[model samples]
Target: MMKFLSFLLLGFAFLLTGCSEDANVIEVEHPEKVTVAFFEALYNEKNIEKAASACSPALARIIRHYRSPQAVARHMFNMSYDKVEIKPDDSGVKVREQFKNKAIITVYFDGYYQENRIKDVKRLSLIQQDNKWFIDKILKDPF
Candidate 1:
């Protein structure tokens, strides 16, 4: 019985051990790839809510970011343009360091302008809070 208890405890510890790194050394499941694909699907469908849904909640207060999934949904449901699309450029994460229950993603992408086929690139910073990722802020770097 003692041996079994020890083994069980060991297993639990292993499962609990998710590594957390500072700044750039964090390990995560293909964050960049997932972000890219998610954006593609959301923009192509013009499903703004679904697009914002991929992001987290804590990032709402940041400038150049969405307040909530509902906010995005409302905007999409009530947009003057009615047609907005996002195309990703190259994406790299800034804060790979995993927190207790959050992560951050900074994505660089290009989007199609609604007035015409002209394209405009946008660099977006996102935060993952409560197991969800959301827009953190809009960045100004092209590269």
Candidate 2:
């Protein structure tokens, strides 16, 4: 009887341990981080897929026009940021005539393209679809 009880207790313990719930891990993406990641992927990593992941669908369409992914990424090598801001307006409801599914990110930076150093600001408009942000449009103010 003693041996039987020991086996039963061991089996019960194993069953209890196996019944634990799995850990739930959720990933949250911040707009500021996404902006930095976009540039990093474009320049440092030279990865078009990764960089394009940070853009909106409209931008993705444009990126496809390049001869290759590398060509698309090369456009960012001379870009450097000074400041960034994200404004999340009502992206779900019709209130005060705000956007329904978009966030505006303003990036102040220095553009050094073709040996021309220029202080400029680019506004990145992002859209949320299926819980992910994508670059939709880039509005640049020439310096």
Report the number of the highest-TM-score candidate: 2
lDDT for residue 23 in candidate 2, whole number 0-100: 15
lDDT of 1 by residue, 1-143 (tens): 99999999998876666321121122234445446544553444544444444444443222115444334433532222224454444444344555533434444433343554433444555555545444545456454
Off by over 4 Å in 2: 1-28, 68-100, 110-119
What is the Å distance of residue 32 in model 1 from its true position? 2.1
lDDT at position 50, candidate 1: 43
**So what's the TM-score on candidate 1?**
0.39
Clashing pairs in model 2?
Answer: 55-135, 56-134, 56-135, 91-100
**lDDT of residue 55 for candidate 1:** 43
Q: What tens-digit string does per-residue lDDT give for candidate 2 at 3-108? A: 9999999999888776532111112355545665665555445556666667766676676566454566346323432232223322454322365567666655
Local distance difference test values of all predictions, in order: 0.44, 0.55
C-alpha lDDT (0 to 100) for residue 35 of candidate 2: 65
